[model samples]
Structure formats: structure tokens, C-alpha cells
Target: MKVLLFFGLLAIALADNTRFEGEKVFRVKPVLDEHVTLIKDLAKSIEVDFWSPENAEQVTAGTDVDIRVPAIYLDLVYTMLQQSEMEHEVLIEDVQRAVDGQADTGPSPRAHSYTKYNTWSVIESWIDSIASSNANLVSKQSIGNTYEGRTMTILKLGKKSSSSKPAIFLDCGIHAREWISPAFCQWFVNEALTTYGSDAQMTSLLDQMDVFVLPVFNVDGYHYTHTNNRMWRKTRSRKSGSSCIGADPNRNFDAGWCTLGASSNPCSDTYCGATPESEIEVKNVANFIRKNKSVIKAYLTIHSYSQLLLFPYSYTYDLAATHNELMSIAEGASSALRSLYGTRYTSGPGATTIYPAAGGSDDWAYDLGVKYSFTFELRDTGRYGFLLPESQIKPTCEETMLAVKYIAAYVQKNLY
Candidate 1:
């Protein structure tokens, strides 16, 4: 009896250490009326990482939800979802494994692999290296300081395009838990440097347009995720008269405030702040966009797990004046992305395609008159949630590069 009890306790401890919750992303196609309510209920019961028309058609028609799951519980959830009668497809089942930064791979290199799986300190050094190497092409500016006093840096890639050339703004890792988000930012920079001369499209882009890249918007939250909890999302700034430690910066934008699909409870993941731009980081980015409104024609923000391409109207799912044009461009980008590896990506407006999320960066950019705003949810459809492995960094970014270039080319041709 004593031996059996000991084994039972050991088993319990092991299971608890593997206590991973699935970020189950579903490619859910809904039957318009029946599907809308179903998706909502599923979101209520299980967390929906992302939702948009790009990935799913409106509930009035067939729509698929791209679901993501954390590493530990992926198998369990995937098997369960597979057995369910719902018409769901699992696009990618790659798992993001969590390992020590100093895992015994070999002797440490001379310098940190700052562009990959890096902390804020490493990232700062990496940026400094790039700037020092390419004095003419790269210039850095401190937009402002985050709550923790870390500088919010922005890289102005390429000369500001002609007043009529149309500019695109790219920001990533707004949510700290999505490490892969920042990875793409660094990958973008590497690609730009490596292929600038040989890649015709890239070369043309460099000559014609200005790309503003904010590698990580929520620096404090990102740092916290690395040192403390792995799943920490949102900014680290505390609100007055409340004990909640952070606010969902994405949901704290000024566009629609927090009307639908946002939580007021500070503890909730989707908590919107007391007011729009409540977080200093958001204000800094917003201010930059506002200051550059005439030239900043497009805004592209990246997040992870869900393979989605979304446009404006996150506050509400209704179509925009340029909805037809934006939707058409998104479709083109999706097709380009698919060409690389038959990777399937959905494109559509925010409200009709996914849950109503107010205060999204894309929507705010659109409201600020940056009409070509978009949000790309990158990498695995779900098996490994936020722990996307370092191995996938190359292919994921490469495939995404096609879509970005395609969009840039399209914008160039149609720039008015």
C-alpha cells in the first residue's frame, strides 16, 4: 500500500509540471447562422487565439477557425477536435518546445544569437550591431520608454518614400506570450540585409518605400515572459486604483475603445485599459503614426499561431470604404504565401471573420487614415501554441516574405 501511494504521488507531480493549456486554434468554417453562435460558444468555453474573415468565411456561409494549442496539451486537444464532427482542419501541428537559453548545445558563441530566441538585452545589442554595420541604411530612434523604462525603439528602414509612394508600418510582439511575433521582425531585417542587392523586389522596395519596424511593442511584458511566466500577455503597466498588473495593448487602442470581444476585468487576458492609449507604448506608436499620417499608407502588425491575414473593422465586423480593395490585396497576399509551401492562409475583415476585437492596431491605423492596414497571425495552426520551435524560424519567415513583397508590389502599382 505504501509503494502504490508513492507512485501515485509521483505521477501527479509529473502531470502537474506538464500543466500546459492548449491555445487551440481552429480553421472553423461556419454555417452562417448556426456557425456564428457556435464559434462564440467555443470561444467562451475554449480560448480562440484569432478570428477573422481571412481564415473563415462569415457565419452566414462556411468559415474555418484556425486553432492553436500549447505544447503540453496539443495532442489531447487535437485528438479531441479530430473526433468531433465539426468540419475543422489542422493546417500545421508543429510544437514550440520550451528549453533553457543556456541548454548545453555547445560552447557559447562569441556573440549572442540576438535575432533568435533572445531577451531584450540581446535584442538591444543586435539592433546596435546592425546600425553600426550599416550606418547609412539603418537609423534608430527611441519612440519612448516602456513602463519598465526600457526604450521603445523603432527602425526606419529605407528612406521615407515619396510623399505619394505610400509607406507601410510594421510592428510585432504586441503580446509578450507570442515570442514568434518578434522573431519575424528580426527575420524581416535579416532578409532585407541578405537579399537587398540580389532580390529585385526587395531592392525596388528599398529604393521606393519606407518600412517602419517595431520589433517588440510590449517590451516589459516580453521581458516578463522570458524571466518569469511564459504565457504573460499585455503590457506591464499597472492601472491606478486597481491591482491588475497589465492591459492588453492591442485592445487598449483608441479606435473603438472596448465595445465587444474585450474584457473589463483586469485579470482577463483581453482586458482593455481604463481608456484608449492607456499604455504608454500604444501612445508612442500611435503618436508616430499620427505624425506620419500622410506617408504611412499601410500598417502591418504580426502575431503568432493562427495563420491569418486580417484587415480593418476589428471594433466591428462591418466592411470599410476600401473594403473591396483591401480584401482583394489580402487575397493576393494569401495566394503568394501559399505558393511557397502550399501553406493555407485566410484573408478577410476583422469583425465578420473573427470575434469583435476593439482597439486593434490595424483598425486604429485605418482610423488614423493609414488605409492599407493589416495584421498577420504567423506560424503553426496549433500543435505547439506559443512554444514555436527555433527550427521553423526560416521557412515561416520565408513564406511570409512572399506575401509581404506581393503586398508591397501591389501597393506600388496602385499607389495614388
Candidate 2:
């Protein structure tokens, strides 16, 4: 039995290794109509993975576009760029080298470290341990199962109260490749537990409100990223008739239902599900939020590769009803975050700040009456992209903690 178990774990470890040998990431500065059209045309011509500005549709004049090109297309991409007269630079030369350099060392069975990017199994174990260890202030709840049958666990953090307290629903890793997102969630949980008594603000917030932390929102996709592909970004559900494996959970919400900045085609990275909440993972979360609507005063979803603090209404160009207030809080949080390590985060409604991404969780949460809903795009704007180094985990989480605490402090004080 022990021998069998050992072999099983070995197989899992071997499968988790992903190598991206000769791939290159490029940053293109599209400054004209022709440049933007070229980017769109290039995407259609080949499998160009847009890292920044999200999709080819968002590739507008004067915007910086980041894209990952396969080894086979590198020469073609370079030649086309030269002919088109578009200004561009290589951000990453050898993706596998970057991936190898991202981590400090080879994998070891050391106890889970918040500063390290743990595998899904390690995170799962850490979740169990942390929740069990801090039972008084943190309790675990399995909201549902992922498409691949992994349990979706949420940790509720706060002092136990006689009655239900107004809460904040915080989730991370909605897009699997954004590893730093889940790291922040875990860090937030640790901070809330470790600082409760000594930190007056944290104590007061806990005394007054609850925080629900879904450490990894898209469990299946996240696991897949660790096991199969380092850049996989959607849920891991297979459609009966389609070959596509997943839907973009972030783009699977019901706010605007795939109208803008999203694709109906299953093969797209930003493919909205066949319908809103079509992904079981999204449905489970939406159902939980809907059931707890009366108490969930704020919704915070974390993503990465752009340093932005965004609020609702990404589905349309129209501003959110609480746009000004949301902007103020986001700016304040951004400022707080900047004070630590000088990281600057642009703050505004999602549509104007970034692009018109429909069916986002923040938008759906806001429309569901969670007025303080916000989405955080964390870490370096594009240097690392989704493959942010593990060494950065500490500082990233440290700075983000300030912004999150700022939001939590504001939510606590403003709760009616």
C-alpha cells in the first residue's frame, strides 16, 4: 500500500512539470489604425495569446499590447511587425527559462510557505491545516465541487458572533494562470488571523463583520495549470460536442452575458460560457452569493498581470451607480498599496480603466446589490505577465494586504 501511494504521488509530481522552451513574449505599441488592425489580423492568422489589453478587440491605438508567440511564429511575427512599421520589443526571450527562473529552487516537501507558489495539492493541504488550526476565527465550508470533482472550499474569517454579521465575499484565482491571486487570498487569511487582537483595525473589523475567502475560485483550471499547462486560464469543463476544455469563469457571469470583450466560441481563451453561470464553478459561487445577498456587503475578486483597482460596470461603458464612491475607495486602497514598495495601481470603473469585459464577477456582484464590489489586478504590469516569480510573492502579498485592509476598514466603517 505504501509503495502504491509513493508511485501515485511520483506520477502526480512528474505531471506537474510544465516546460515552455523557445516561446517568446512581445510587447507591441500600437499607435495607429493600421497597427491595431494588424494586431487583430495577426491574431486571426495565428494562435497569438494576448497578455495585456486582454483581447485583440481591445488593441486600440496608443495602447501597449503584450502577446505570447509560439516558437514557430516568432520569425513570422517579427517579420510582420517590421513590415507593418509597428513599434515592439521582446519582453521574454525564452519562456521556459523564465518559468524555470520564476521559482527559487526545485520542488521539495518543505512545509507550506506563504512566500512560495505551492502546487494545488500543497494549497489544498494548507487550506485544511490553516482552517483546522484556526477554528475560532476561521471555519471551512465546501460550497460545491469543481467540474473535475475537486471540492471548492471557502474559509469564513471573523470572531464568532451571536447573530450574522455583514460580510465581504473575497475570491481569488478566477483565471487559473494568475497564481498570485490565490497567494494573496491565503496571505489575507493569515494576516486576518495573526493580527486580530494586536491590530485594532483588524480586530474591530472582525468584531463587526465577516470575510469569506475562496482561496482558489477555479480549482480545476488552477490544478490544470500546475499539472498540464502553465498558461491555462479557464474552467476545466468539457462540452459534449466541442473540443474546448473550459470557459473563462471570469467571463461566465451574467452581468452582460458575453456581449463585449468576450467570445461565444468555445476555443477562445476569453470564451464566455454557453450561458451565464454555465460553468458549474461560477454557478456554485453565484448561488452562494445570491443566498447570502443580505449580508455580503462587498465582493472582491483578484486577478493579475495589470496593476489596477477596478470597480463595476465592465459590461458597458456606462459608469456604475456608485462610481464615484468606488473610485474613491479604490484610489485610497491604491494609495495605501503604493505606500508599500511603490507599486502604483490605476483606479477606475473596469470598462474605462481596462477594457469592456462582460460577465465579470465584480460586475455581477455590483448588479446584485453588493455596491462595494471591486476587482484587483495585481503585481507588475507586464514584465512577468502571468508567470510572476515566486520571489515576488512576499512583497506582492505584503503590499496588496494594505490595499485590502484599506477596503475592509472602509467597508467596516460604512456598514449600515
Candidate 3:
């Protein structure tokens, strides 16, 4: 028993040591043409990790670029930025401190709460309980399994009907470190169940359309974040002949596979994988979406840190077929979201609004005939980034709820 206990304690110690002690996240704004090349050169010289925009390749003039640098390179990075005359600021002075400060220190909990960042186990249990408690409005389906054999459960929320109803598909946490993404999904479930009859918009939404919520899209990576690394951001899949263990599930779709804004290197954060649908998690979600393409009208995939509501064609500069209508709806949704907290969100086509990210699920969904497809990048511009505090969870989710409801209501009305 003592031997077993010692090994268990050693495991916990190793996990806790994964925290970023001396790492700092810097936000730099490039003004001159040489500044971009300077940032690229910095990445090539050292292990500079791009936090926002996901890659150094997306760093451009007029946009704030956030990158986390190792302790040893902090002085060198600051000197380089000064010499290059690039404007920069430290967003997070200590990354480990920010990571540690994300969770609530109030008290121990027996059950999951919407305001807290719950672990994969807590979330799984909450799903079962919530679906059981709200039997008529919520039911779960095991769509498929992750690469690590963890079950991928999607919760279907709607009023039971004799016949099938048009549905909207919403998924969150496709990239694992964005804890707020999954939190919003769980909060959405809570709001839907708690305000089913009282909230007029929600009631009408359930009455007209079924909403499928995949609360945690990247199960394996999410679990890894809680157990091993707080910043793990890909599906935990091991491929033969590669030292790396995961692929960017967001970039694993068939739409413009391995194109711009994605990496062919297996070790990259935005690694597109061996081929389209290379990750089992992506393949599973794709298969489910394909299976229910007839009834699924809208696809909303939630992400974080950048305040943007984007539509399809992220793979290319080409505008989506339904560009005008999608842009109008996105602007409306952004307006609704901003009304709550005065939090502004830019609305436009993903490629033009941001950078060209190929193989994104929204692009693929739009190509698959899901006309009303969108991707939501939620909360604070760059102050918090991925390490958003737990206190902001309620406000963020509450405001996001408005935008999601607005979209759902619109989709229901325009279901013709």
C-alpha cells in the first residue's frame, strides 16, 4: 500500500510541475514591414510560442500579436523588440501564476457549477445528471469515441415532439486550453433547462428547433489539460513514425485541408494532421454532422480570446455563397452580445476579418450545406487570453447566451 501511495503522489507532483513558472506572454503590435519578419526571426531563433492567432505566420501589421516566451529569452526578446522599434507589452507577466489563478479558491464542491471550470470527469457527470433531471428537454447521444477511447457525448436539447424538428449544432472547446468555451456550453445547458418555460425566446426556440450541444469537443486534450498540461491544445492521438502526439482538430476537416494558416509539421499547435479527418475526434464529429445533415440547419463552433463572430471561407479569401445574409446575421448577433456587457465583437468572413485558416469546421459545415454556420471567439481582446479568470465565466456566458439565442431564433424563423 505504501509503494502504491508513493507512486500516486509522484504522479501528482509531476502533473503540478507542468505549470509555466517563468514564462511570460507578450502582446506586440507590428507597424513596419520589417517588424513581421523580426517576429518570424524571433520564433526561428528561440522557442517562442504564439498564443493568439495560433501561429507566427498570422502576425501582420495593425493586429496585436501575443506570444509566450521562455524565461531565458525574456531579456533577449525585450531587447530585440526595442532594437526593432516594435511596440510590445507584457500581457501576462507570469504564465504559471495566470494559470493557477484561473480556478476558484472559494470552497470544495460536490457538483459542477456553471461559474467554475470543471474537469472532464465533473463535466461528464454533470451531463448525465442534467440530462436525467431534464428528461423531456435534454437527452444525450454517444456520437462516437475520441482517439484515446473516451466517449464523445452530445446533448440534444429541445421539447420532445412526435416528429423530427430542424436542429442547430453547437460545439465548444475544439482546442483544449480554451476553458471558457466549454464553460459557455455548460452554462447554455443550464440556462436552457432553468429558463425553458419562463424565457420566451428559449421556449419558442425549443418548440421550433432542436439544439445539439457538444459541451467539450476535444475530450482527450481537455482531460490532458486537467491532468498533465494546462495549455495542451490538440487531440491526444499518437501516430506511428511521429514523435508528436496530437493534431489540431479544428484544422483536421476536409475543407481546404492543410492549406494556409495550418502547419504540416506534426509538432505544431496548428498541425493539420496526416490528412483531412485525420484525427478521430474530427472524423467522429464529421460523421455525426454528415449523418444528420438533413435536419441540421446551423453549426456554431465556440472558441475564445479574440472577440469575433465569423462565417465561412476561412480556407480561402473567396466569399461564401450566402455572404451578405451571413454577414447581416453575424452583425446582428454581435450587436446582441455587445448590448449586455458593452463587449464589442467584429463580424465578417473569417478569412478577411482575421486570417485564412484552412480546414476549419465552420468552412466545412458551410460547404456541407449547413448554410448558417459560424465560429464565436469569445471574451477579452488579449488581457486574459486563454487564461481567463473564473470570475468572468458568468458574465461571459450570460452575454454569449444572448448572441446564441439571437442566432437560434433567427434560424428558427428562417427555416424555409
Candidate 4:
């Protein structure tokens, strides 16, 4: 009886983790209309997961589309690619191998490390401890609870002041699978606290402006990725009649909600939710921002797997009112980031720089008077995609810190 119970528990544990055994990630360069059509057709036919560009509809000529094909459809996909003669290469030969190899070897330390991918519980504990330790520099407040009942806390980093300070709202891990996004947020917090008095630029930014850091925005979805599916991108909310779980928190915002580059189908990775602010997580952040819109001069949201620093108007092709200045600031920030490791990052409006991803938090924030809104797609373009290795975390975060500080400084200088 005891042996049976032990084996039963082991089986349950193994069953919870969704393994990507022979799945392959391919970077297909769609140069012609035919190539784009072919790619779209393949998505309609099989369960092709778009790693970059987010979905099939966003695939266009001259852009390299990275997709993950299931093991079962590998032969079919290969045949189609060969017949079409589309330029393509395998980014990840086996996703399971990449997942296994992404993390550092040996057991992870019990304590959270900035250089490693920490789970939600670990991050939560770290948030509490860090805020407590750095009482003068950081104070945490629970904005709200996620759909899964996880407390969504934002750490306000600045010296305590008698009068309210102008602020920048920075959030990471809007998309659950982007572990590096949240990692960078943690790094930013650590860097801000540890280098407060010593780092002149950081000290000035913190002293003058309060920066609200939501380390992991989609807390429930992030927790799901660590415990169950490493590739889960949406929230874990369930509808009554539908079996599909979660909506893309990034696409659930009110700005051009459910328009281009988003899907109405709940099962889609980029599902825009039933309505704007449908997902409780999105609502939580949106509500918090709305309440503090007066003092929140800038908004920055972090995402990963595509090295691009994008500004507003993702919902439309129209130029932002402050386009020229935004572009100049982005260019400077990109230059600052590149100085560290020579990791190139393209800078421009979100729609033109990448695909038009409507309902993005940055676009929503921009329309709500946060003129300095920006979204960061960090790390190697597509080599590793969502499964970036632990080895690159330190370098990625270190360089990203420069760009973020550059933006904060710009916002600080321009505040009237």
C-alpha cells in the first residue's frame, strides 16, 4: 500500500510537467507573398506556435518568422518547406533539450539569485525580503491579487519624500513565458538598491523620481510556467463553457483592443480576452496606473526573445505626438545598451519596428498621457527564443539596466 501511494504521487508529478520532447523551433524568412501565405496555411493546418511576431497573421514579407512545430507535424512541415523552397533554419532542434539546458547545472540555491530564473514563490519571498531590508529605498504595496489569487505587489523605489514625486511605472513578465523579462526587473531592483549611494545616475533617478517596479505582472501565469508548462504565455483564467485557459495579458488592454495582430479565439496565444481589461491581471495593473496617471510620467513594459526597444502607437500606423523626441531617446537608450556587450537593439515605433501588436500595455499607457511609454523586447533575436539560457541572464540584465536608466534620466530631465 505504501509503495503504491509513493509511485502514484511520482506519476502525478511527472504528469503535471508538459514536455516538448521532439518539438523544433524554426526561423523561416518569408521573402515573398507566397512564403507568407504558405506559412499562414501551415498555421491553419497544424499547431504551429509563433515564437516571434506572436502569431501567423503578423508574418509578412521580408520579416523572419520563428515558429515551433510539434514533433508529430515535423515531417509534414519539412516537406512543405522543401516544396516551397522558403529560406529557413532550425533555431532549436529539440525544445526539450533547450529547456533542460537553459538552466544552470546542479541544484538551484534555496535563496533567489538575480542571475538565475526564480519561481513566483521565490520571487515573492525575495520581494518581501528586499523591500524590508532596503526600507529607505524600497517599499512594496499589493496592487491587487492575480486571477489565481497570487498577490501582485509593486515595489516603489525612491527616497521617502514629504511631497509626492513624479514617477515611472515599470512592469516585467506581462507574458508568462518570458522569464528573462522578470529576471531583468529583479536585476533592476537589486541594482537600484545596491548602487543607490554609489551610482550617481541611479542615485539621482531614485532621489528625484519614484520608479514603481512590478517585478512579475502576470503572477499566476508565471507560476504556471514554472510548475506545468514552460511555454505558457497567457493567464490561467478559465471560462465557463470553454476549455481554453487564460488570455494574453499584453493583448487585453483597451488600446485598439481585439484589433489587428490579436485573436478573438480564446485558445490563441494572443487572444485579446473577452473585452478590454477582461483579464483580472490586466485590470489590476491598468487600474493602478489609471489611479496614479497624474504623477506617472512614463510607462515601461518589458518582454523578451526579440532584441527591440519600441515606443508607442502599436495599435495604429499613426505617429505619436512626441515621435521625434521618443525616437531620439530610444536611439540614445539603444546606444547605451549596446555599449556594454555590443548586443544590438533596434529602436522605433512598435508597429513599424516589429509587427502591429494592438492592445499592448505600452500603447494603452501612451494614450492615457504617459508620453514616455516604451516596451522592450530583450536578448538574442531568435536563436534561443523563449528558452534563453541562464548563462546570458547576467549580461542581458546588465546591458538592459543602461537603457532603462537612460530612459529614466530622459523622463526626469523633461519633467516640468
Candidate that would win on lDDT: 4
Q: On residues 1-416, what C-alpha lDDT tens digit does candidate 1 reach at each position?
A: 12222222322111212223323344655555555554454344433344333112223356555554455445444444444445666544332223332222433324555235777777888888887787656678899999889999988777443354456789989999788888888888878877877888887887787778898899999998877766678799887788668999999998788777677877556788878898999999998889889888788899876788999888986788899999999999999999998889989987766557887888888888887888998877655556666667667888998998888888777667
Worst 10 residues of 4 by lDDT: 5-14
Off by over 4 Å in 3: 1-17, 106-110
Q: Is candidate 1 or candidate 2 better by lDDT?
A: 2
How many clashes does each candidate structure show, in the order listed?
32, 0, 0, 0
Candidate 4 structure quality by residue, lDDT tens digits, 1-416: 12222222322111233889999999989898988888887776557788988999999999999998778777777777777788899999999999988887544746799889998988999999999999998999998898889999999999999999999999999999999999999999999999999999999998999999999999989998888899999999998888888999989999999998999999899999999999999999999999999999999999997899999889899999999999999999999999999999999999988989889999999999999999999998888989999999999999999999999999999999
Q: Tens digit of lDDT per residue, candidate 2, span 1-416? A: 12222222322111222567798999999898988877787777667778987788877898899998877667677777777778999999888888778788666544687887777888899999998998899889999999989999999999998899999999999999999999999889998999999999999988889999999999998888877888888998999899777999989999899898999889888999888899999999999999999999999999997999999889999988888899899999999999989998999988888889999999999999998999999988888888899889999999999999999999988987
Task: Give TM per candidate.
Answer: 0.78, 0.95, 0.94, 0.95
Ranking by TM-score: 4, 2, 3, 1
- Once fitted onto the true fold, the runs of candidate 2 whose alpha carbons sit more than 4 angstroms away are 1-18
Give Cα distance to truth, residue 367, candidate 2, Å.
0.3
Full-model lDDT for every candidate: 0.72, 0.88, 0.89, 0.90
lDDT of 3 by residue, 218-252 (tens): 99999999889888899999989997789999899
Ranking by lDDT: 4, 3, 2, 1
Find the number of clashing residue pairs for candidate 1.
Answer: 32
RMSD of each: 7.0, 8.4, 7.3, 7.2
